[model samples]
Target chain A: MVKTHIVKFVGTSNFKMFSNHMATIVRLAAQQQQQQKRGMATLKAISIRLKSVKNIQKITQSMKMVSAAKYNRAERDLKQARPLGVGTKEFYEQAEIQAPPEDEKKLVIAITSDRGLCGAVHTGVSRNIRDALLADPKERENTKIICVGEKSRAILSRLFANNILFVASEVGRKPPTFNDAAKVANEILNSGYSFGSGRIVYNRFKSVVSYAVDQLPLFDKNAVVSAPKLSVYDSLDENVIQSYLEFSLASLLFYSMKEGACSEQSSRMTAMDNASKNAGEMIDKLTLTFNRTRQAVITRELIEIISGAAALD
Target chain B: MSAWRQAGLNYINYSQIAARVVRQALKADLRSEALKRDEVNVKFTQWKDGKPASKYIVFILFYLVVL
Candidate 1:
């Protein structure tokens, strides 16, 4: 009876070992199947990424082309508008119209645009104002900001929310006009901010690839009247002065808007061009990776089939 | 009195009228190009509760375009 019990225990131990071995085999088979699925999933992911990258490349390329055309038109319009700016500025310089130092109230007209993705065009203008405001705390207290475009407003509103008077939108959608300039100047005139001095800060279009922040000096009626050169001209009456002031303001605004628009378009062109180039590089790398993975998947399957056939034989 | 003030028009309105006349006075090809700048399309929105208000208030400004 003792011999029979010992044999029964040994038989049960052998059966347990066989079952454990079978379980390990099944686990191995499941892991291999999972690995194959993972390989296919990776291939699908790479394909999807490659497709999306291609689409992005196409969009950037189109944007670059559109900006190029707009830049050309802006450059042409800028040429005609350049003389107008020079003439207006020359009058101010000759008249020696300057704001008195004692005048504390100030206005800053920041020129940018509604659109973005132009790469630092709007930020450059906003940064200039921020620097000025930071340099003089007193100026910050006395100054009123008029944002000509939505982009500059968005940037300055974070800290100087109260300083902003208003934001002008629906601009930069098309070529700026004298009428548009007049409308903006009209609003400024009527806003009753009554600033003693002002400056129009804008991005001056230097070339297709470069731009510089520039400021055009603004003067109130008092400064214009107090100018020493005002004595040189005879019979310059109040109405004439008013008309001239209004016209000059409009002219300057028009010129600055044109310059800002040109700079915006050129910068957008450069930004889009760079984006397209980067997308192209990514596409090349992704295509190489995608092809390599696809080839590897095929090779892996072929190897599996061949090895399986060998095992069968 | 200036014709603009006499007509009860501000400088902006006067300028628009003057610009239209100038555009009309331009030579054929230049006139077409210059007139294109006369078009003004503006939209104004009032925000409430951190969102743009649902109703749009359209204010149509009249411009006297000289033929």
Candidate 2:
């Protein structure tokens, strides 16, 4: 009789790196086992692989739970923030404020988060900016990028480093505040780039498992003041307009950050859930292979013992 | 001049200070809930490598600790 015991894996700070390597190894092992090559050594290897996969499954399960908790808060917050964003945008639309078409200079603020392991949340935002950059050479030359998180900066910096004005890191580590948005908005206002117009590229939350990269238009003080319908509003002093621009920018940033956070949490929950499921399937396959190999070894030994006895007879 | 600017705060700090005041002035029932939104403990670091060695390691540690 063969007894199998699970070997405990001592996790380190570099566990993510270790788990990534284990995932690839498991894939290769699964492929090798598919060829039906069975032996005692292979049985031992399968047991070890099974242990690691089980450990990873446990981690993924816990990660899924954590993400679920975060998702609940994020979704709630997003509900409140959505109306604020919509109202701001509606004002801009009703006023007919748009960037002057001939103004070539543009700023692109890419809103993402520092953390990853969420399914393509950061990548979606970066790809939107990348597509815009690639679409027009002239626009690319005039465009300046302000990345809101480290993940997008890491990706976009590879090819468009020159285009990036500055990057804001440490985002999405905690729930964002209005104060945080104000800080980011103030940075943009003071960044000395003096861009004619801009658009914020962000991932809009659609559903629990899905998100779409969306763009929100940004206008400078000049564009806002130059709108044809501005004359309809009375008592609009310079101070009020300036204050509104600043406040509106912060509110828009706050709203978009909330949406991105909600999207990220939901996507992470889904990603971890899928990872746990895949690990379960892998463990099942490895267990099947282990049992078959153990039986094969036992039968081979029995055949040798019986043949030796027959020779003696 | 605003109280924040009088204390020599920059525009960024000034705006944040003002926001805090507004959150503080919410009604008793609403203030507690609104105050929750004021807490941000995010830490920032500059990345020198592709993997963001220092900050990424800390993030992973925190993630594991939470689990």
Highest TM-score, which number? Answer: 2
lDDT of 2 by residue, A274-312 (tens): 777766766777788789889988998999999999999
- Cα deviation of B42 in candidate 2 (Å)? 5.7
The TM-score of predicted model 1 comes to 0.80
Pairs of residues clashing in candidate 1? none
Off by over 4 Å in 2: A1-20, A23-38, A232-234, B1-15, B22-36, B40-67
**Mind giving the per-residue lDDT tens digits that candidate 1 earns over A9-80?**
224222232334434543554465477674544666556656755775687779889999999999999999
How many pairs in model 1 have backbone atoms within 3 A of each other, for residues 3 or more apart or on separate chains, i.e. clashes?
Answer: 0
DockQ of 2: 0.18
What are the candidates' individual DockQ scores? Answer: 0.21, 0.18
Task: Calculate candidate 2's fnat.
Answer: 0.24
The lDDT of each candidate is: 0.77, 0.78
Per-model chain A TM: 0.85, 0.89
Deviation from native of the Cα of residue A102 in model 2, angstroms? 3.3
